[model samples]
Each structure stands twice: as structure tokens, then as C-alpha cells.
Target: MTKEMDVTEKIIELLHELEHCTDSEQKQKIEEMNEIVDGMDEEEFESFFTLKLFNKTDKMIEEEKISMESVFLLLKSVGQHKVLMHSQSYAFHSSSLNKRFEQMIIEEEKKKEERNEKLLIDLCECTVLLSNEISSELLSIIVTCLLKVALKKDENEETQKEVEIALLALSYIEICKSVKQEWYLNEIKEIIKYHQEHHNLTHLAYQSAWQFLMNRFHFNKSLDEVIENELHFSRDATKELEALIKCVDWKRGKGEEKRKKKNKEELFLFRWLQTLGIFFFHWRLRNEECVGLISSVVQVFRASKDDNREISDKCIFCMGCAAENRVVENEDLLKIGAVDLILEEMQGPTLDNYFLERHMKCLFEDFRRLKNAEDYKNEEVKRKATKRKVFDKMEEEGFEDCIIGLCHYICLGEFRYFSLFENYPEYFVYL
Candidate 1:
């Protein structure tokens, strides 16, 4: 009781001091108050927050007695405390405060006052910190405000920085149920489209935002639902993929040099392929639609061939996913010479990249299975016929000898087949 009383009394004194403190002193007082708050037990914290600190800070901000900086510091400190963050008092106060920040952001967008940038950033950070605690309604308001500032047609560096922060904040927050409105979905997608179309946005910031939108859209719902809910989602996804291909300089490093580190564009492209892989796996493109899309993916695979193994592998992985679509077949992919490209990569002299090899093999299997699906209408005979047809095709292409040689290499441990051991331990046991 004595300790709690001492802490509460000290916090009260600091709050009083804040009403009169200079700019420099404000940080010190807030930091001291945070330190005092940090020392309190849960019961003491609940008591202090409900009875004293919440009303005090709200009153101070209402009266304009404390600077925005002081409010941010206090809120930052409160957000850091687990008990305080989960409390009803904190949620109510944060929602109220966020509304003020949302309005200020709108006003500041028109004003473009450099001085207010830091405050805007702090407010966004607050949104990020308390994201899991706040209602989705409040979250959407702040997001709408941030997007308003971000989607401005002008190429202002300060605006870019603000949008970057907003993107980072979006990346941090989980998608809540309430924010699943169509406009919200479109707003998020617009960020991705904007980044693809505009050179003004920073690559790293917009990439994070793109990833956030893709992740939530793909993971949070069933594929059928995703396709049904969004307007022209399939067309938009295809366009986004094509736009990314154009954005990349596929000629970097002659397509043969091992990249010690991927640049921003490389990272972005890699992520693009990964998300699209997820997209393709769940959603099947129409037969008419498959041509252009598969052609684009095949182009990426061909361009990346012999250049970046990681990207080449992703390209193959994506194609493998695409191959699983009912409309996509050995013919569509082969018509684009995708099968031949995979065979070329597989037969490359430097086939030491395990993932690249594995992906190529998986794609071959996808092609084989898809082809067999077209050939064998009887379900009982399809499995047996598929194997015979695969061997027959291999023999016709003089790949039978190659398969024997690969088997020997696997038995001799000349290849990195740890994946095989983990996935099919019986094969290694037989070896």
C-alpha cells in the first residue's frame, strides 16, 4: 500500500509539472512518470490508470495544456505497459486520441506543415502499438487518413516518408474482421497498384505495404471467397504480375552471377512470385485466361534462367502452382516452351542448387500428371497409365538414360537429396 501510494503521488506530481514544464523538461517528466508506472504492480496500475492518469492526460490534452510531443510520450509509455494497454480505459482514451490525430492528419495534408510530420508519425506509431486493442472502425479511419496523405499525386519526399511510416504501421497490424469492407480492400490494393505505376514511392516502403495486402487477402479467406468478394480480382492480379515483370531489370548480372545479396527490386520481385504462387495454388485461371498469364510466368522463368537461382526457383515454383490449375496443362505450358525451359535448367552443368533442381522436377511431375489427366479418362487406370506414359515420353526424348544416371547419382550421394530422405525415407533405406 505504501509503495503504491508513493508511486501514485509521484505520478500526480509529475502530471502537475507537465502542465508548466518547458519543452525539454516535458520528456524528462514523462520518462520519469513512465519509470514510476513501470514499477507499479498490476492492481496499482489499474488503480492509477482508471483513477488518476487517464483523466489527467485526457484533461491536459483537452485543455491544450500539454504539447503533442508530451501526449505522444505519455501514450507511448502507456502502450508499452501490457496491463495498461489491455485495459478498457486505455482503449477508450486511445480511440478518442486517434480521432483527434485522424482529423489533424487531414488538416495537415492541406497545410503540408513540415513541423507536423513528426506528430503524424508519432500518431501512426501509436495506432500501430495499440492496433490489436483498438476497434476496427478507428483503425479504418486512421488508415483512410494516412492513405489520403499517401496517395497524393505530388512527389513530395516528406509525403513519401509519411506514407512509408503508414505502410510500416499497416504491416504491423493484423487484419481485423470489421475492416474487411470493399473500399478498405480496394484502398489496400490501390497502394500496390500505385507503387507499381509510380516511380515516386520508395521501393522498400511500398513493397512492405504490397506484401501486407497480399498476405491478408490470400491467407485470411478461402480462395473462392477472395475471388468472389473482390471486383475483378483475377484481372487485377494478372495485371499486377505483368506490371512487376516490367518493373524488374531481368538483364541484371547476365542471369548467371550468384547474387550475394538481393537488391530492393530483387527482393520485391521475389516476394511477388511467392505471393502469386499462393494465389495460383488456390485459384484456377480460365482456359482463355491461362495463356497470357502462363506466358508471363514462363517469360520470367526463361529470363531468370542461369542468372539468379533463387528467383529461377521461385519462378519454377510459381509455374508449378499454375500447372496445378485445371485449365493449365502440358499443352498450354509446352505451347509456351515452358517444359523445354525447365528441362534446359535441369540439364544445366551447374545443377548444384538443390531447390532449383527440386522445383524443376516438381514442375516436370506437374506437367506429366496434367498430361496424363488429359489422356486417361478412367480413374482406376490413370495412375498406372501415367507412369507408363511418363517413361515412354522419357524414352522417346532419350531421357531414360538421364533418369538412370540421376538414380546412380542419388545412390552415390553426388546430389543433395536430403529433401528426399526427409520426404521419402524408404528410398534412402533402399539405397
Candidate 2:
């Protein structure tokens, strides 16, 4: 039988060579060390290191005898490698690693859906603690694996919050040290940005069970997407909201009641207008900036053929909202013909003009004209067949009002290729 001293001596030698070991050689040594160390008792494992050195070091730490540099190094050595992507134990002894232990975290988190977030919360705490204390190399592996778990759209909201908290903790810690500070800070920020942008992120956790699975999946598609909804609020829906969130704010203040009630729908239209002003003002040369502008700052860019069209879906909702709430008090906005423009766009094969006109009249605002409302109808018979049935009926039922609105809309708006508003003339917000 191999003596414990022999194993101890071998581990000590490999550990001592940590600084000079090449990657392949270091991996080989670690594998060998794992073979011996795997079965060792705590006492035997401790024997592998210099006892006097550990004792003196522990005593110094206990007695506050160590310098700051020493403490930091101690943290970097062990804590830094909090979790590796593939644990050597898991890689080597696949059987012992077992479905039981590996599935425990995932299964526990799965059951947490709609129940309680305890397990997911604990996972977050563990991940964050590791992030703060682990070695950079090991932390990278852990973070990448955890991100795969955390960013999954199917993941529970609790799990997402957990990830956010973990990133927040890392962000805070990175704000502390100098050596590992910048790298760590950037990593956490990127993760946060990814979650904010991605639709596929929560797929691992949420799957098909989430209510937001279809409608609210990923985040707001765009500013207009929500505005078109009579109910959903626009991200640029409010001054305060626009400054904070980057995604479309479709559900801003979703369940909240009014302080004094001044037509939530109309007020939301103002939010939409404010956003329009913003995007138009921010229009510039930078590509990303242009997208941000139309999506949040200016609404016109929604029509500007570009990428991220799904994101621009919010513009439809906002337009619908504005069309729904065409109040006389907002004549200045009406003069811009936002509703008229939106209605014209909706006149295609897929659009239900009758529904639009019905909703349009719900606003109680005076519409300017309908002289060109039919122009929006497509020439394709098959395309217009379904839409005409709905729109033509609307013309029959409320023909006078729809025509009035259309006329008012066209005459009211001071047509311009792009809005002249400086706040969001035609560009990205000054982010």
C-alpha cells in the first residue's frame, strides 16, 4: 500500500511547481494530485502542505499579524477558483459525480418556478461569493457556466433576480480592488447588458410555463410596439422612465393607479410623443446610436428600414395608443399627424382598418381628414380582401368620423421628413 507521506510529498512538489508548470504539464500534475488527494481525509490533505507555514499564517491572520498584500494573495489563491467549468472530480469520476449531485441544483431551481425562490436565491449567493473571492481563471469558468444557466429565458424570474444580484455583488467588489478590478467590472456589466438585450437568455429556466413566454418574452421589442397597445406604456412613456431603462417600456406602471387621473391613455401618448422627440433629436452617424434613437429617442426611425425590427414593434403599440387617444388637448401632437401616419400604414393587407377606426374614435379627439385614408389600401386583391371587410365596415358604421379624423390628421400634421425637435430630432439619445 502507498504510504500517506508519499502522497503528501508528491502533492507538495507539484504545488511548489505551480508558478513554472506549463499548461499541459500543470494539468497532468493536477490530475496526478487529484488521484491521490481525492481519497484523502481532511487531516491527510492538510499534511500535503507545509504545516508550519499554514499554522503560522493562520495564526497571523487570526491575530491580525498579516499585511494587506498577504491577505489579498491568500484570497486569490483559494477563493478565486470558487467553481471551475468542469470540476476535475466531475471530469474524472463521472460516476461518482453522479446525476444526483449535478441535477440537484437544476432540479431544485426547476421546482422553484411559482413556488418560492430559496434554492435559486442560494445559488445566486454562492455564485456571487465565488465571483468576489475566487481566482480569476477559475472564476471565468464558473461565470461562463452559470451565465448559461442564468441567462436562460426559461429560467424563473427568481433565478434572473439571483443573477442580477450576483452581478451587482461582483460590480460592487470590482469597484474595490485595483489589480483585478477593471476586468471584473467589465465582465459583470457585459452580463447585465446581455440579459437586458437577449430573448433566449431565460429559455433554460422559463421554457413554456411562463406567462410572459410568448407576449413579453425577451424584453420590449421596441418603443412603438407598446405605444400601439391602448394599455401598454411606452419606455419613453415618461420622462423618468426614458432616462433609466433601455428596453421598450411597454408595461411601465402596469398596475399603478393615477395620482389624479388625467386620461392614462392620452398621457401615455404624450410619453410616446416625448420619445419621438428624443429619437429624432439623437439621429446621427453612428449605427447603434441611430437604432437607439428611433427605438427610444425618436419614433420615426421605426419606419427607417433598419435592423432590430422586432424591437421596433413597440412603435406599433404606441401609435395605436396615440390613435386611440386623439384628444383635442394634444392638437400640437395631432398636427404632427402621428396617428394619421400610423393609420395609413395599417391600411395594408394584414391591417384591420375598422378595428383601428373603432379604437381611433375611442380617443374623443377631433380627427382632421380621411381624404387619403383609402390610399393606404393595397392594390393586391387577396391582400386587401380580408382587410377591406373590416375597414370598409368601419367606413360604413363611422364613415363620417373616420373621414373627419383622416382629414384632420393630414392637415394637422406639419409634414417633415424628420422632426425638428432638438431633444430627439432624428438621432440616438445622448447616452
Candidate 3:
């Protein structure tokens, strides 16, 4: 026989023996086979290992010839590329793999065994790779399993890894357009609270929580409302926000090296800021809390404007929303210097289109309110002065004429020129 045929026959023989072997013997034989496969070069590995092992996974599972543990090891060895390539055709083609994963989760719960927990964690990692293939029902099952692992009271390194992986999986599933039932909402909240309390898991928890909230917001607005309302008044949320604000190293030291070191924390802080902004829009904050939130957001907006566009954009949106909602009144906004900071951005050279549009909307609304007062530009000169400060800044920055020209165009019924300002009706009356 040819050497290739001989090798194939020997592999087949080993598989046959693996089926009849004891657990110990099967493990030894599987390890030896895995070693042999692992030693092959990339091309050879694809032909012999990937095609032979994973492609036949269903048949092996049906015949009870290979354990899930073995399959997981093989998947890890082959890496993500091959797995994702075959995922749709092999791993996700049938319901069997999902059922097996569910069964593993059930077994772990009943036994509370570390080995089973580890296995489930490994499977959870695999799910992250196969997220695009996960169905709604399967996604729910995986989420429940991961949450159970994450909520464990154990505080060991292994337990933390489990929590990290679980949160990672939830984050992935959250972005997959997964369906979340109402019953799962409370558990998700608890997960968020628990991870928020754990120092090491805070980022992961918040990321997962944000994803969950956003997914729910997309699917069912009321469910998101429930979670947001519950979280808005929670001590945990308040503490987390405070902690996030404190973590910011405000000193923009000399050199790119220092700035790079701070970028990670800054990114996390921005994400937290974005989440808070969304929550603020939904839940009414007390005056003090609202002011504090605005102050932090404005600080970020100022710091990020020149260096980070993403954060700068998010901060501006948050500020504009706060202004529009009157979360803090015009007087309060000026007290905290929010209006001044916003005017500075509006007059800056690098103005974002979205930011300018929203800022103008805020200015239009404030101006219209001032103009519509009973004392119309007479005794209300102070309010007019306060309002004109924004336009005054614009004029100083050479943007006043542009604003006036746009206003005149809109007044003359040239609607196409101001389509971007369509959302703000106040602009028509005031500007």
C-alpha cells in the first residue's frame, strides 16, 4: 500500500480502537493522536487533521467514538480560522452540538464539579468563535450557563477566568441580535451588579451590561426601561460611576509614551461615560447627580477633542442631550461652564458635523425660549445676554456670518440647504 494510504488505514484503526477503549485508554490514545496531528505542517494539518477530524465530528459524536473534551482540544489545536470556515457546515449544521453543550451545562450544575465547569468554560470560548452561527434559543442557553458560572461565589483565578470568558461570550451574543426574554433581565442585572463590585471584572461587566442594555433597547424598549430604572437608583451604579471618574488620570503629561499608557483607561472611561449618557436620557437624575454627570462628560469632551475623535463625539452628544433635556437649566449649565466649553468646541477649527448640528439645535431652543418670554428682549436683557454669549463666541470665531447666511436661506424656504437641521424645528423660528 502507498504510505499515505497506510497512514490513513492506521488512523482508522486507532479510531476503531478508541471506541472500545476504557476512559483512561481512550484519553491516552486521543492524546497520542492529537500529538501526531499537532506535529504536522500547516498544509498537511489542513488535509489530515482539519478535514479528517472536524469534518467527521458529527459521525464520531453519533457513534460515541470521540468525547466532547477531545473535540474541544482538536478545535483549539486547529485554531479559529479553520473552525470558522467549517463552522457553518459542520459544527452548526445540526442541533446536536448545541444539545451537547446544554447537556454539559446541566451536568456541571448538578455535580458542581470543577472539571465540568472548566469544560463548560472552554465550550463558552468556542461559542464566542461561533457566535454568528448561534440561534436565539441556543444563545439563551449559553447565556444562562455562563451567568451561572460567573455568579459563583468562589474568588479564585480559575473562577475569574470563567467569569471573564462568560462575560466575553455574553458580550459577543449581545451583538448578535440575540433575543432576550423578560425573565433573563433580572439575572442580567444581578450579573452586572456582581461584576461591578468585583474590581477585576468591572470592565468586562460593564461591557457586557452595555451590550445587554443596547440589545434590549433594540428589541424591546420597555425591558431596557425596566433595567435602566432599576439601575439608575442603585448604589452600585452610583459607586461605579464615581469610581470610573476617579480612575481618569487628568494630567496630559509630555510625550506620546505617557499618553499611550493612559489610553486604555481613557477608553474604558469613555465607554462608561457613553453608557451613563444613555442611562441619563432614560432615567431622570437628581440635580446634584445630573450636574456631576455633566461636569465629567464636559471634561472628557475637552480632553478628547484634539486627540480622540470617538470619545469627543460621544461626549458632545451627551452634552447636547443634557442641554436639550434641560437636565441642568441654562443657568446651571453656565455655572458648571458647560455652555462655555460647548461654545469653545463649536468655534474650534475641527468641528464635527453631528456635533455642530446638535449644538446649534440646543442654541436654537435656548434662544427661542429667551425670545418667547413675556418680556421679549426688553427686561429680559440678561437672559438675552446669556443666550447671545454662544452666538457671540461664534462671531468671534468668524462663524456668525455663516450661521446668519444659513438662517436666511432657511427663512427663504430653501429647505434643501438645511436638511441636516430638519430635526430641530426651533431653528426655523429663532435662527
Best by TM-score: 3
Residue range with the least summed lDDT across 10 consecutive positions in model 3:
80-89
List candidate 2 stretches off by more than 4 Å: 1-301, 304-313, 319-328, 349-431
**How high is the lDDT of residue 74 in model 3?**
48
Which residue pairs clash in candidate 3?
none
Q: What's the TM for model 1?
A: 0.52
For model 2, what is the error of residue 428's alpha carbon versus the real structure, in angstroms, after optimal superposition?
Answer: 38
Task: Report the C-alpha lDDT of model 2 over 54-163, residue by residue, as the tens digit.
Answer: 34434544455443233333322222222211011112112221222234445554563463344433433343333324334333433433444444444566666544
Per-residue CA lDDT of model 1 for 1-431, tens digit only, reads: 25556776777878898888887899888888888866665555666655345556667889888987888877665654532223434543445555675566556555654546556657766655544554554565556655555565557887776666556556445534344545356666566566656766665465556545655655454434434343344454466567766777766656554444344455556656665666666665454555666677777777676566677787777777766565465555656766666655665667664754565455555544544444446653644554454445445556544444566455565556544423332222211
Model 1 whole-model lDDT (C-alpha atoms): 0.59
* lDDT for 12 (candidate 2): 57
TM-score per prediction, in order, is 0.52, 0.23, 0.59
Candidate 3's residue-wise lDDT over 1-431, tens digit each?
A: 24656444555566667777776787787666665544443344344543344445657777877777766654444433333122233334244554565566556556754556567667765655443456564555566766676666466777665565555456445434656575367777776666556555646455655555655555465764455455542344445555655666655664464242234456566556556566555543335556766776776667667766666777767766666555565656767777667656666665645566666655654555555565344657667666676556555656555565456545555543366565444543453
Best by lDDT: 1
lDDT of 3: 0.57
